[model samples]
Target: MEKIISHAISERVEFVLIAGDIYDKEDQSIKAQVQFYKEMKRLEEARIDVFLIHGNHDFLEQERDRLELPKNVHTFSSDVSCVPWQSPTGTKIHFYGFSYDKRHIRENRLGDYRKHGDADFHIALLHGSEETKASEHDVYAPFGLKEMKQKGFDYWALGHIHKREILSSQPGIYYPGNIQGRSKKETGAKGGTIVELSEMGATFSFFETAPVMWEKKQIVLEGKADRTEIYRATDELFQTYRDTLCSYVIDLEIVTEQASKFDADEWLQLFEEMRTESPFVWINTLRFIEKNQAVSDKWYQGQFLADELDASLAELMEDETFF
Candidate 1:
């Protein structure tokens, strides 16, 4: 994160926009604050401003009011508010947002941010879950993508869902995701977006900032005739992926009925010993797949309802793309 912030110095961007969730906790540690202060100080020295809001994870109630922020750092109010920034080129950009007052915000706060300003770029800054049946989120600041797109804003800077996606490009609604992958679940290139404006409208692009990445890889051990062959095949599998571009925190899944043959402790020990053999692979998980564990066709023959559910579960679990 510090490295990326330092990189901003050379980018010559007018300002940095962080939608929300800068810290994991509202009451962030002194070490984190000090580090942030130093980074912001550097940004200020480069004449780069930073505009940000607080997400539910770092709600307003948990803010440290005593710590003085850098002059270049601008924070939004707890209530919905709009701040307009005029570039030296006379282009006006209005940023609208509010921080979470409580831990869970169930209300649809989009109503508060009705884009009424006339500016070269009107961007809505939001930090919450999008309304979709497929999502398992706790419905924080629930909002629909359709309504957001209809608001006539030039862009939507969204947060909380740490998976960079541009849901729409017509008006440019973007989620930059998180700058750092704090856990294995966030597995991919982690970074922010760079948007350029011209007569052609806004052109968006992404940059890589994460020092380390989390990735999942599965090695099939079914064809290995015995434990010795299985061990050899696994080593070959690692060798094949040893050329992975970046340093990786890997969750390795070994798929085969041979899982029962090896002791977990010994397998992990072997993995640890050879982990450094690959330049980039670090085994964060060593899971053994127990192949053919699903119930047989005979078990589902008599019970129709049970068979239907069992079939669905099997499809969900066995489908290679489910994850």
Candidate 2:
């Protein structure tokens, strides 16, 4: 976050749009408040405006004594609200958004986003998941892509289901993902989008702010391979990424015919011995993948079991009695 603030200052951005999830906890600690305030204060001093909303992780609490932020920082209330701003170049922008008052919000608030005040640009900040029958994300503030398109907004800045997705390009709908990958599931470059808008159209570019990245790599050992061959192959893979600028937490998968015979812990211990060789890379997880397992009867059995489980889940989800 410090890096991001510094980048924004260096770039001299007119404003910063933080969609949601600024804090991990609903009850924001004094330390978190102090750190965030200091960053926003810098923006205030630079004559830059900030617009932000609260996500499910850090919903609003009426009774809590909220820290007063700088006047330049504008926060959306629980209800859908619109705030207009005129840039230094006299471009009128109307920002529409709402904050989460509770952890679970099943309401579909996409329709609530309406262009207001005849502004040059209409941008909506939403922190929610797209509505789907089945999804890895929690279905909070559920919305459909079609519904979003119908709203007629100039741009949509979405959040919650991180893994930066570009849902649409015509009106510039995007989820910039989280600035940092906190888990193995989120493995890639993490950053925010820099948008330039005018009456003619809009242009978007992504800026990288993450100092550390998470990556997954695979090493294939053809046929029967001994410990020496495995170590050599792994070393070769690490060598490829030795000159990279950033540090990485790597999930390394070893694929071989004798995968079942090799132990993950053993290989991890061996790699740890060579840790000094590549300081930029750290092995987060070591998995043994059997190359020929897909053709085996056990694989077929596993697939059948998975299908059955999915079918059961679908049926359960459809049952009105459970609801």
**lDDT tens per residue, model 1, 142-245:** 78889987888877788887888888777877888887787787789997678766534467778888867888887676553476866887788678767665
lDDT of each residue in 1-323, candidate 2, tens digit only: 88888888888887999988898767789999999999999999999999999988888888988789999999999999999999999988899999998887877897788888798888999998877666433347888998888888988888786678888777788888889887766689998777776555557788887777988888877889888898788889878877887778889888888788888998788777766543467888999888876346245356657787765665465322132
TM-score of 1: 0.83
Per-candidate Cα lDDT values, in order, are 0.75, 0.82
Q: How much is 205 displaced in model 1, in angstroms?
A: 1.7
TM-score of 2: 0.87
In model 2, the Cα lDDT at residue 3 comes to 82
Highest TM-score among the candidates is held by which one? 2
